[model samples]
Target: MPRAGRPASPLITRRAAADAALSLIDSGGLDGLSLQAVARVLGVSAPSLYHHFRDKEELLTQVARCFLEEIGHQQERWSDDWETRTIELSLATRRVALRHPNAAPLALRFFPRKLMLPAYERSLVDCPYPPQFHAVILEAVEKFTYGSALFAAAAEAHHTPAMPPVDEAHFPYLASAIAAAPASDEDLHVEALRALLDGFRVRYGPRQR
Candidate 1:
């Protein structure tokens, strides 16, 4: 378990400070995280935090990097089935975003693309498809995963709109589909992902047995 309070000593390192900031984000979203707020959580002078992070932007960037590292860790022992690997990797990304919805936007938007090279490079090495197909698969899956994850996070952070009554004469099928949709955002995302994966299988063919 993460420590509940400020560290006992004055020697609060950058990692510890980031952890504290993340905790604040977990509880209250991005609005809750600020250098001054983190310092208070750590029971240290606000100026003290500057020793570890040059500014709030730097600290936030670090937080984003941390989550990417976590996603990388989650992929370590994923299944060999290529489709399964895609699903698990997407879910792994979703799990982190859900966990830190407030901080997730920052990571999704500002986390350096170069930092992702190691993980995606490994995917190229392990993937059986041609490089072009591999790139297509990756891009498609990332679009689905990140777009769904962002929508999920945003839905959690805000109210879901109530559907207006549909005109049966004009849009019956659309209304019926909306009415039958899963209430949970996570469940909806799963169904969407499966559909996307199915499309990929049809278009690109199955991975090697």
Candidate 2:
């Protein structure tokens, strides 16, 4: 039999590797991820992964970049209205985080600020806030959005109740507040965002410009 040329090395694109890493993260979280694990998922040897990723850390960084890219894509539909865009972007972040609760923490660990800055600058251009307050408003919105998404993801993963059991006798006020609160995290998240945006509008609305 004619000697078969050595089996062609499986072609592994950076995107494919990153996606496989993300899948591994979705199933097993950051802890269970390894170059070896990703390679297995791609049906290649661990060493082959080195051709694309120098190390596990680089692989993880790429995973985080990919995760953020997904959020960016989700936000592309945002309208030109600044307040509406803010709300849409925040919700999009939360939606993606909920989809991959296991990988959500990577967003915090390896935030690719450079990749995010351009979009933020565009948002600032559309913001009604005075020039001086643009940076602050942007920072505040981003901080709140990321924090809320992370908390929501953690709560979802742990099956945490929105309101814990409290004794009304000793903590009547707390109990009353809990009773009046929105039952679902999604409702509470929207309510809080609206309240936040309202405050921003009052403090930095067109009048301030």
Candidate 3:
């Protein structure tokens, strides 16, 4: 049975439900998540969850926005070189994804939707490049970030196994790199992210090589 007039505190109702949903993702991978599960955890009717978020997609978007807002908060906290700030943003978000592996796939798309646009918009607004040329810079940066985030999230969700041991003689370079660098899945992912940032610097940073 259920007992409810509107919650005594509407904001608490919404935040409690959202946090519960995120907690469920933390406890059980995304496959284990459902709006009903969130409502049950929060001791509310599922309709109440709907009131806060139109659908699961909106819920996911809100979660992703929460993640972006966290990044913005961190950026505000530190004044640092832009490259370091960018790395901190990427690595911190990766840690957040690892913490809530279930919700990551849904959350990853937020980069293109909300994160990158304002960044590119600000650059276009401030930089010397013409709009057409700035679009090139935007395109290059997005291709890397979008691809890397999705790939890392999927890998973590799937618990993708490390590259299997292999005959080094057959694939010399890859084998040597794997053995010498010895990437845990997370390490490979972070390094790959750094590589993308490096590419962007060459293409878009001052004194491009």
Leading candidate by TM-score: 2
Please estimate how well model 1 matches the true structure, expressed as its whole-model Cα lDDT.
0.78
Higher TM-score: candidate 1 or 2? 2
RMSD of 3: 4.7
lDDT of 1 by residue, 133-172 (tens): 8878788888888887777666555645334568877998
Which whole-number lDDT from 0 to 100 does residue 34 have in model 2? Answer: 90
TM-score ranking, best first: 2, 1, 3
- lDDT of candidates 1 onward, in order: 0.78, 0.85, 0.63
Every model: Cα RMSD to truth = 5.3, 3.3, 4.7
| lDDT (Cα, 0-100) at 115 in candidate 2 | 83
User: Model 2, residue 117: what's the lDDT?
Assistant: 78
Q: Which ten residues in a row have the lowest lDDT in candidate 1?
A: 155-164
Ranking by lDDT: 2, 1, 3
lDDT of 2 by residue, 1-209 (tens): 44487556546878899999999888877888898888888888899888888899888788889988898788446687888878888888999999988899889898888888788779877678789987788878889999999988887766785456999999999999878988778778878998999998888776753
- Per-candidate TM vs. native? 0.79, 0.89, 0.71
Per-residue accuracy of model 3 over 28-122 as CA lDDT, tens digit each = 86678788998888776777687678888776666666655554555445334555555566666666656556666666554336465775565
